[model samples]
Target: MSAPTPSARVTLAELAAEAGVSLSTISKVLNGRTDVSRTTRAKVEVLLDEHGYQRRGTRTPKSRLLELVFHELESAWALEIIRGVENVASENGLSVVLTESGTRHAPGPEWVEGVIARQPAGVVLVFADLPQDCRRQLESRSIPFAIIDPAGDPAPDVPSVGSANWAGGMMATRHLIDLGHTRIAAITGPADVMCSLARIDGYRTALNAAGLPFDRQLIRYGNFHVDGGRDNALELLRQPNRPTAIFAGSDIQALGVLDAARQLGISVPGDLSIVGYDDLQVARWSSPALTTVHQPLIEMAEEAARMVLMLREGEEPNNLRLDLATSLVVRQSTGPAPDAVRPLAAVG
Candidate 1:
């Protein structure tokens, strides 16, 4: 917001003060985001000449900001991740800037380029990916990054934090098997997602361990969101031999599965037991309460923040990826499989 100062260095806050504009307006101008009004943009441009506000790609020693980007912020679990990052950041006198990339967890090259230009102390990416070129750009600029629960496979050298997804998946399936569920199904996230595949492997391993034949038809690959769960559940439940138990990849999807069962008048626990991953808050609010895997998402977020901070201090973590513990949290949603059920046509 401040006037032009080609040779001077002024913080964004100072520029905003001089231009009498909000910090966001100044940022939009700085990032060339194009959402700002022409009138405000013109005013800000005029002030840019007086104050040297364009930090550009300069790695300022005084910059205490950390950029946190999410692919999508609509999930209930997102709040928990935010709180964890904020807690660590606040204690270390670091501020956080939040960015949301469209529907995917990782933004495109354009967004990555903007972040590189911002030159924050470090960046934390959640449920997203960084292209090799983008990763190189950040490294070339001495910017370190950490990914949490990465939605895709990360480079071998990329720092990341997540849970034991395969083990968690195995645990969920084992529980249903222990309840005497021979006909079981698992609705997992996208097949390409690393975590999703790991979870599917866990499920398959558990079934094999129990001496149960692995039926590929019992597996459904879909999005990790709620609607995907419901639609996938409908397909499975309408089949001639629907599963007596179901394992949902996420709490959000599990909730959708619950809805599908209700729509079909299938009494949960009594007729169809359910299990879900991610012990998000909504799991506790489900009609029968969700039996879920505790993925330790908050802890993962906290570890990611710490890792990025350490990187900024020129510290290399001992490991490329940090994995916290994951365990099952049994609740009312899961029970012993029922002895019999009406035909799929009757429910349909």
Candidate 2:
């Protein structure tokens, strides 16, 4: 069957009649209410889509609130993000509404329903991608959204803010190489994560550019946490020909590496050098200040908030994807390689 013309105006009553449902049922389906039966809701939604139905006059008024959603609040950077979002929200006389939604991939349906009901000014989601259904619901109501993706992976069509993860990795490895460390190892986040792959690629590239050998055995992947760092560092440090320097994926992981070095009676920057990612507060507070990559978490959050606000104002973003630069922060955690250490077996 041919689809209805875009210029044709379709009313809620017409949609209800076409679906053989009550007008309230149509409204419930539109609002994402769970009370309506799936079959009925599906019928109404198909009709709505066919007719290009848009609730022009009935659009919910935007509230004086901005929604900042995270899959979880446990990360060290969560506070930084919150501070940045609040900075923008307060300046614009909008209160920030924080929500911890579903998995890292997307927010749950319940969160979507709450957002549709509240009709916030805009939303900033810390996720890899926004689910299509959620995006449609938000867009249908004229609610704008942006993704703050630290994972170095985002949907191309979506407006997103992320950091230069590959560059950060390259900087960390290059620093160690410049310090005359030939036997270096790296522990990054999960192998499946795009950021992890980008970082490891950076590490390999730096090694290649410096005429150093890339040893697969010297690379490890784990969660971006203290335990992942500690466990992986212990294994790498326990080897007879252990690396003289280690580059960690996250600041939290670097702490774990420090603990491992201490347990093995290895001196920081004396017998072993360490570099970490994310210049978090704890990085400076450690026994030996951590040498790390400075990811602009707060600035990234601010940029995402601004982008959403721009969209709310019916303005298009200059760029759908923005990757902020990363810089290396030198600290006491890294130093030249020890005299006794040498490059891996393949490199003499």
Candidate 3:
């Protein structure tokens, strides 16, 4: 008997015909579209596996293009993260697509839908909250996705990468405490964000550990922007029982706090000490360099991108909760408490 020749590449039409389904139904099942029954999807998936068919444009049977979604392109923080993602994707010979969530006023929902239509290998969400419906759609389709600094409710089992925000918060507050500052205030990011909440918990933990009472009056809410930081700082400074030190959740907010102090004619470390999180380039170049807890943003981005690629290749990534450590960098912005008052008695 003659040896049988292998069939050519399996087409969508062939898979549908073999499965005794319509082409459109097969397409929906293969691409993870809605309105498909679980039984039908399983059957189609099995057929694809049996035939050794490859997705279009993929070099290897498992290779794929990944998409990165960001809300704003102008933010240096976001840009650095994107660079990290690109570096990892390039090194692995994978393709990447970039999409912006549109402007602050008019966030474009269409872009997300468009990415889903294109069916990239996976997705990486940066600093933006994704809708529940979108998440559900992706889950139904079996598209792998990961989030970096996610601000929304994350799905269980989905991988995520972020710095140790709570630890960073604790480090920042502890740095202030070590500088002999007992009356320390905190400026936090949006209340809904997990990072903000984690940082707040850290701040409270540090204060409690030092035998200090957790004073709610010393905490202020900000939008993680410079203007918000400035406003919060001004409000804190106007209070009768003002804090001797301030910890801003982000570098931008720290800058705002510094500006507010300058406007009020208060000398940094002479009368007020300030600490910031996220040691972006601006933190070091400020008039008095910011003492901050540095979160490895680039490394975080790289890890997130790498994980997405691994998922695309059908590899189970060993790392699930990749928690990066944070360290405090002392600088001119912090010093011993001002000579204006005596230290409070330790609680314990």
User: How many pairs collide in each candidate, listed in order?
Assistant: 12, 0, 0
Worst 10 residues of 2 by lDDT: 339-348
Give the per-residue lDDT of model 2 (tens digit) for 1-348.
Answer: 243565777888988888888989988877777798878866876676566565555545557999999999997989999999999999899999999999989998779878877778899999988876677667656688999999847779889999999999999999999999998999999988999999999999999999999999999999999999999998998787899999999999999999998877788989999999989999999889999999999999999999999988778999999999999999999988888953333210
Clashing pairs in 2: none
Candidate with the larger lDDT of 2 and 3? 2
TM-score of decoy 2 = 0.90
How far does residue 305 in candidate 2 sit from its true spot (Å)? 0.8
Segments in model 1 whose C-alpha atoms lie over 4 Å from true places: 1-59, 102-105, 108-110, 113-117, 344-348
Residues 1-348 of candidate 1 have per-residue lDDT tens digits of 233544556677877888899999987765556688878866876655444333455456787888888877886668888888888889889898888874464566556757755768888888555665456556545678899873466766789888898899899999999999999999999888888999889999999999999999989999888898899998888887889999999999999899899888888988899998989988998889999999898888899999998887778898978889899999999998888867754654
lDDT of 3 by residue, 1-348 (tens): 121234566688888899999999977765656588878866876676566555544323453677888778777587778888888888877688888886532236576556656777788877444454455555444567777763344544557787788898898998888888899999998887778889999999999999998999999877988998999998888676778999998889999999988877778978899998889889899989999988887888898888877776678899765777888989889999986733333221
Flag regions of model 3 displaced more than 4 Å: 1-21, 24-64, 102-109, 116-119, 127-133, 136-142, 150-153, 341-348
Judging by TM-score, tell me the better candidate of 1 and 2.
Answer: 2
In terms of lDDT, which candidate is strongest? 2
